[model samples]
Target: MKKLNVTEIQEKPEGFVASVKEELNVELARTLKAGNRMLVDSDGLAFIYIIEDELDYYYVSFGKGTWPSLKKLLANQGSLDLELGNSLNIELTAIADELAFLTENIEGNSNYGEEMEKAVSDIFL
Candidate 1:
């Protein structure tokens, strides 16, 4: 959650490493302990923070550039697939289910039901 300025990042280049060390308190044996180069795709329109641990590679997104790239990639495959929409719908459904369960649990249980209802309504709205 630490917001680093671009100049600070550019000056150190290892700013993320330092941030990680300070935040996570991990002492790396060597600088190479940090794996994979940070990449900014096209003028900082999109950036990726990649880390590799053993045979596993993980990427964390800090911005919204991937969506257009993903859409383009999907389109190139020659279909207007609803996969993304479906995934979002599934997640929303899960949230709705959880809200319903919480509502049932709060029924006839003092002010809990009102609070739960308000929270669920706010999220849905």
Candidate 2:
């Protein structure tokens, strides 16, 4: 795997795009820490790789029933009816979701062309 620094990911994420499993899987795993974010995929698996950390990352898999709530909680960065753990976990969750969004949209092709403006219609009301 091509280990990438945060900057490299930010500048050119497309370079890392590949098969979902190959893109999300890591060789080594680590414990989640404060300020650590997750790299998530459509499969509901989340990976963690902090700065200067190994290419492999600590990961957690969520079930279908709960994954959506967790994903939403992280994306919104707000408190929800769901309960997981301490403030640190909540914070980390939020960051993880953000990272997942970035990876999913850029590397996963979840939002391609969504930002582009639509063509004008000649038959406007």
lDDT of 1 by residue, 4-119 (tens): 11111111221111111122112211111223344433333333344434444433332332233333322333211111121210011122233234434444544444543344
Best by the lDDT measure: 2
| Stretches of model 1 off by over 4 angstroms after superposition | 1-33, 41-45, 64-125
Q: Against the true structure, whose TM-score is highest?
A: 2
List TM-scores for all candidates, in order.
0.22, 0.31
lDDT of 2 by residue, 1-125 (tens): 33322211111222121111213223222232323444434332223333222333333333223334444444544432111223212123344455445444444244323221110011110
Question: In candidate 1, where is summed lDDT lowest over 10 consecutive residues?
Answer: 82-91
- Pairs that collide, model 1: none
